[model samples]
Target: MTLNRRQFIGTTATMAAVLSAPMVRAQGKPRVVVVGGGAGGATAARYIAKGSKGAIDVTLIEPTRKYYTCFFSNLYLGGFKEIEDIGHTYGGLAAGGVNVVHDWAVGVDRDAKTVALAGGGSLPYDKLILSPGIDFVEGAVEGWGLSAQNAMPHAYKAGSQSELLKAQLVAMPAGGTFAMVAPPNPYRCPPGPYERVSMVAHFLKQNNPTAKIIVADPKPKFSKMALFQEGWANHYEGMIDWIGDDFGGGTVSVDPNEMTISIDGEVTKVDVCNVIPAMKAGRIAEIAGVTDGNWAPVNAADMSTKADADVYVLGDASSQGDMPKSGFSANSQAKVCANAVRGALTGSKVFPAKFSNTCWSLIAPDDGVKVGATYEATPEKIAKVDGFISQTGESSDLRKATYEESEGWYTGITTDMLG
Candidate 1:
């Protein structure tokens, strides 16, 4: 069999395994083991391998063969996209010189600089990048837990959960109620729950016009609050009843069996409930001992974890100051980390770290809104330098343009992350 340079780089580890041996490091080539192949890990892995030109060994550990992005899952729920449209495979990365491992990362041994797999093997690395995303905080929402997900799907992780929530939405009785228990601050996508609310309202408006939407939010205000409120009032008028912390929205509980939600001592039977509990870094970060209870703290300049310089954390899991926990932020952070790690591994030029993020939300049809900011790495943190956001009462044409911009960005970012 013949192999190109990139293909050879990808298959070297496999060849070592075939010989019942550990990965070969004949010439002191640096290896980077990335856990959680979402926006952050995949981009970092690909960038390192591509940038090094086969000088660095990059292996990505992700459980799923196909990854569905959480960023646009709401669009899927809103009927704007099909499930297949959001699903992505790792073949591109595998072909790009990254060894994509489809297995669960069970543990991390920082001393040995190795990651243990649930399938019973380990991969040693000179550097480890973790971007495992968010995990629900246990008992954050009373009466709701992982076991109750079928009855009240969070749909936060995308893929099957997103499909399950859509199915529940479709199965709702005519004019039945759809409820959401919004997560607390510092969760993935600050505007996500609200965008989801907009999408659900859009779906309900077309299919079940009489259906009602209720949101019990722990926050008094949310990202793009004024814009989302304006969109809701204009498009989904009288359809959504949002209970904020000021109105006892934070004080809530639920029952999956009865399909009911209680807010401020008032209980109401619900047809569909989405409980997005408080979130923390994915468990792997904690197991790696890089997390400070809830999130992994990292240096703003390079995204290297403070716990261990050789170990890096990215995306929603990292408590990098000022960046929202969105896929855009993860992708942005990944590039900086990749450059730094590649420089550390090889004699590459390391550039100054700069980051930017833009979060877009579709309200109803062509009505969309967005908020964004540019950031620089400061000694204290990743400090926001300047920002912009879609304004309230904007012309429909401008709003439509914003929505179109978001679509273009989606295409560009997905390509950038995987390719």
Candidate 2:
């Protein structure tokens, strides 16, 4: 029978609750509860339900109706992609016979193996996966908070914030200055801020050529530094000035009301400011009592929490070694977790754990650079067994091919995660 929008939502939520109850397992099916349907959670839920072939019931809890990928978001700023290009839906996952619940997982009762929802429901599960990604540290940048987002958009989450930043750039006054407060190391997407700088510069060169870009980076060095620096010089020469820690980037603060940012005790008035604060594991992982400090420590082999084997963590929230926090890394970790979870629940033969990740950064039109590695599970962590990165001054043809490869990968990965 066809149902209206309200009825459909109500009926699906009821089905989610029933399939998530602990007693459902006594009906001869193990329940898997996955929180935060992004690269990690979506991939894990899809793999578990599909691999089990109905032997296990999978439920995914994500607050957003549509998931916008953080990867390639810089491309959005560069006008390389439209907003819809980066957005995905759970309709594919739901069609695969998984319960897709759009609700916040506000709490986790580890002792009871249940997840407390923001909408007044509890989901019981034999196995739990948390991939809630990152949350900003409260005091990382003084005078900057959620309330001031409109004045200085971070655009790190890649949706409304992205649109706001793009509009600000377009509306920027001639010869106006744009400043970026880059996060410290070990944050999500190491090369991301630099790529954003490149994209913003690409936009300004044509629209507002006299507009200047300033970067306040706390790190003395960054991922793909040589490549990005070279590309910046070639494409947007003299348009970008990157201030590193050695040059007082470490001592910086923002006055959002005044539209000014202080660097090394010198405050500069900026037409726009993008402040990317320090990040930590999402709250639900901490609520689950799985976090060790800023991130949840997990076994590299299976993405299972070190504190509790039955509960797993993936993506930016996980402190698994040798992998930067990117969509590629999360998707890789989720596959391993899916295999292990399926084995535990269905007595399936588990394969040896292997993972790989490649982060591609678009410096300019058809000029892309990348860093990637093959990883293997070890006693200590997910150690990098081999790696590769683009070199400075690469030929234009190769860089163009690399950029093409990134486009293809984006299409392939989004399909993989959403499906």
Candidate 3:
């Protein structure tokens, strides 16, 4: 199973032949296979494919033909944005000489160094990057499952469910109640659930003033808590209610058919519900035996899995300390992982890695909140060296500017991923 010099050279030649028609193909370079063409995987693919100037054959295996970012998903739910605005295509990656395979990865044969695709094929890689994102703990809420999603939408992943939740909100009666069950700490996008509450309240205030939003949170505090509370009070007075872990508001079970959630042994019914369950690393990461508890463990030096040297995990799937599981973090980690993979394949020196992340959430159309951090790897782990949070009571003008900056970041990052 060892790749001899002749065999390695022959494989490179075959790759070159296969990519001859593509003007941007990297000839005589090691073949790299990346799974999950989301923020992290796509960014890694683009950087390694383009940065190497055709010195690496990059193939991205992703099931979806298009990607929808979770960042601005609330805007869509609040009727401020179209779903199409969040959707992006893979054509840019293809144009950049990346072989974009539209297929789900069922498994990875670590011993064989091959990725098993759902389409009855396998692709080998000199190095692999995986960033499949998060999967919900299905049975975490009693009586809740896929079948129940129609009545109680968990718009955590931000696609069809987001629209479904929004539609329900729109259809609700003027004095109806909207209940949100927020998960415990260490979930993807910590500020997300609260932000969702704000957005929903904003819509209700303008369109249906009598409508109310009750947030049942399993945690005592959440990301940007003070800021969110301030925004809610200042904009939509008495429209939002929060139930922390101490209150009877933390959810334990759900009856989707009844639109009722049980918290602190009391059942409360709502006209509409958004139940975001506890999350874990995506199913593929668990199947690959790379997860520690709920997330994958990686060496901060290069995002390589502690379980497997050949496999690198990034994005919301990895247990990146002091770094939120935000899209920005995933994108930054992708570049670092790409450089490490390139070095491993070509026997080049590994570069010093630095990672950054910023997550912005909107309260009103022009009112935004943000938190960011920067990290650098030490011999032990990735350590946060610098960070900042949006100042409380910042003027609407500043908040609006930050929102615009978020849009610019989306465009820039997407370009970096596919261009």
State how far residue 198 of model 3 sits from its true place (Å): 1.0
Residue-level lDDT tens digits of model 3 in 1-419: 99999999999986765555332325455778888888899999998887777878899998988788787888888777899988889999999989999999898888888889999989987787889999988687777887888899988886788889989988999899998889876788888998889889988988899988888888888999999988988998988889898886654788887788787888888899888888999888988889989999999999999999888999999986778888888999998998888777754446899999888888888888799989998766778999999988898899999989877887887787767
Q: Is candidate 2 or candidate 3 better by lDDT?
A: 2
Candidate 1 wrongly placed segments (more than 4 Å): 1-26
How high is the lDDT of residue 410 in model 2? 92
TM-score for candidate 1: 0.94
Residue 91, model 3: lDDT of: 97
The lDDT for every candidate, in the order shown, is 0.94, 0.92, 0.85
Off by over 4 Å in 3: 1-28
- Residue pairs in clash, model 1: none
Name the best candidate (by lDDT): 1
Full-model lDDT, candidate 1: 0.94
| Per-residue lDDT of 411 in model 3 | 81
